[model samples]
Target: MAALLDSVRAFFAPKNDDAFLIDRENPSDVVARECLLDRAMGVGRRKKSSEALRRNRVPAEGLALVARDTSGHVIGTVRLWHIDAGITPEGNAVPALLLGPLAVDADHAGKGIGGALMRAAILEARKHGHGAILLVGDAPYYERFGFTTEKTATLVMPGPSARERFLALELRDGWLEGAAGVLTASGAKMLEAPLKKAA
Candidate 1:
């Protein structure tokens, strides 16, 4: 049991990679970022509820980001999608952002790279006037970044998800107040190229 306990501790421990840099994802990084995500989230990741929202939808401009090592290989990635928080009391859709698939390569896990990516994404979201951000993640891990169940208690995803893992962070106070119902894609459809098969 000692070995198992050690592994568990290691999983939660932060492993910092000081040589890494975070920046906006560029066109050339697509293949690397997709590979990194597939490695981190596994092949089944394409079926997640977040995937449903992101499929065929372009990420909000300037919000898709990547973390790269000194060698320029993509090591981490996070993208935010434009979504509507259903309809509001006034019958207009509330604009919001959906955060997802924040993936870090397994070899780079335990480092604070994930946290750094989260901070950068949030900062960019706020700077662009995004009011709220929704994601499905561990409440314990994400709570430190101001994401909580308090404002998301009434919000629902388009598909199945653990209620507690469904979370939100308000960039503008009261952005989610009185909001309820299914989250829907609200951006222009994107034309994604088919991922090339790996050798």
Candidate 2:
């Protein structure tokens, strides 16, 4: 039991790598970001309920981020999107951000990259004055960062998601108090390019 306990503790503990640095994601990192996310989350990632909220939408300004190793290769990625995290029972839309698809390269797992990204994103959201943030993920992993299902009890995602896996973190105290309704995409839509001229 002692040996098993120690191993478990080590597994859950954050491990740091001085070689890594968190930075605002650059447009040039798209391919690297996609590969990292695919390796960490697999191809079916786009089918998740959260994808609907992110489809054809852009991440909130300055909230798209990545972690680069000393070689300048993207090893992790996270993006926060604008969402109306449901409405209040009084019928007012509660503005919030939806954090999702946070992924780290398989080779970089357990190096504290995920935690660093999470902390940076939360800080940016607070700096930008977002009221709350929501996500669907394992409670145990996210709980360490102050995410909880408590305030999300009355909220609902647009698609099917496990009740317990839906979680929220209120940046402003009581921001979610009266929040209750279906989540909907509220981010800026992707700008369309001009049609090509016929030859």
Candidate 3:
């Protein structure tokens, strides 16, 4: 029985070097992606400030991405939501993206999938002319990708959050300069609606 259990475990384990393909998330991936997130972040993830921002909204165009393994399982995911950064130095409503809940299946940890997803999300956000991104995450982990607290010092989330973990990355120079006040959802129409129909 012990040998049989070992065989099952070996078969279910993720290979450390498994090849993963990153792609734009489609409607069909919703269920699997949610399952992966639940497995990675637990059911209580909905209570976070980031979730409040993402509620009833859609991710920015081409910014919701997933990483699939060779067998086509959705193993990792990241998304960016449109948000208002209260106001800018010029007194205009500051537009930016809120990145969050970047999750990877526990079995797939340490394979650089999360990093790959971040790079993909940032590159796509820039390509789409987005100016900046905000996320509640570890400074140490996101700093490597250019996120910092310097621009986000005066920014506040709509709900409670750890001040230090709230960081920003500017896709365009000076996007967040002199920006301050509460970060709120953009309420932008879902860009994925057409894609969902096409899928």
Candidate 4:
């Protein structure tokens, strides 16, 4: 993981020749602040208000990543959550990961930082034994990461999101074969097992 992060840092340093680093746990306030201001993205919600910001400060509370510039300024941020799968095709509860809030400062928009953050998240999920991950995003943008609508049809979420926007990626093969049912506390507990010791 260190090597992968080093590569990401190098890739982002060429422009303006600034140094870069990755924060594996919580991102600094600067990064979060800028990300919340990006109107092109849906991150400027109440969920990103000052109260929510304080709530998200705990390290390892969620899988959040941040990239910093030479002066240690936060240039980008992303986060992930473990929530219950809303529907399961086989009646058994489905446990899945949710990826979202991928935000990059306008100055850093064109860089590959967003993609690097996503790749790191997927890699981390697999390392932690997660079966699958889901997201509501543009098909073309997420397709490169193996996320597709075919494996996500049986799943449901509590929102007014478009059906076509729902997508999932099976980190392990056949993970979605019979996965069906609402997420339960037990499922959340199960997913927390791998990270418990890490914490």
Best by TM-score: 2
- Total clashes, candidate 2? 0
Error of 3 at 1 (Å): 47
What order do you get sorting by TM-score, best first? 2, 1, 3, 4
TM-score, one value per model: 0.86, 0.90, 0.85, 0.71
lDDT of 4 at 88: 49
The C-alpha stretches of model 2 lying farther than 4 A from their native spots are 1-18
RMSD of 1: 9.1
- The local distance difference test score of model 4 is 0.62
Q: What would the per-residue lDDT of candidate 1 be over residues 8-89, giving only the tens digit for each residue?
A: 2322323344456677788999999888878888899999988889999899987888877767888899999999987777
Higher-scoring candidate on lDDT, 2 or 3 = 2
**Candidate with better TM-score, 2 vs 3:** 2
lDDT of each: 0.84, 0.85, 0.84, 0.62
**lDDT tens string, model 3, 97-163?**
9998899998988787898888878877887899999999999999999999888998999998898
Show pairs that collide, candidate 3: none
How well does model 2 score by local distance difference test? 0.85
What digit string (tens of lDDT, one per residue) describes model 2 on residues 1-199?
2322232232232334546767778889989998887888889989999999999999998889887777788988899999997788888899999998899888877788898888878877887899999999999999998999999998898888998899999999999998888899999999988999999
Q: Which stretches of candidate 4 lie over 4 Å from their true place?
A: 1-19, 27-62, 87-90, 181-199
For candidate 3, what is the lDDT?
0.84
What lDDT does candidate 3 reach at residue 90? 72
**Could you say which candidate leads in lDDT?**
2
Total backbone clashes of candidate 4, pairs 3 or more residues apart or in separate chains? 4
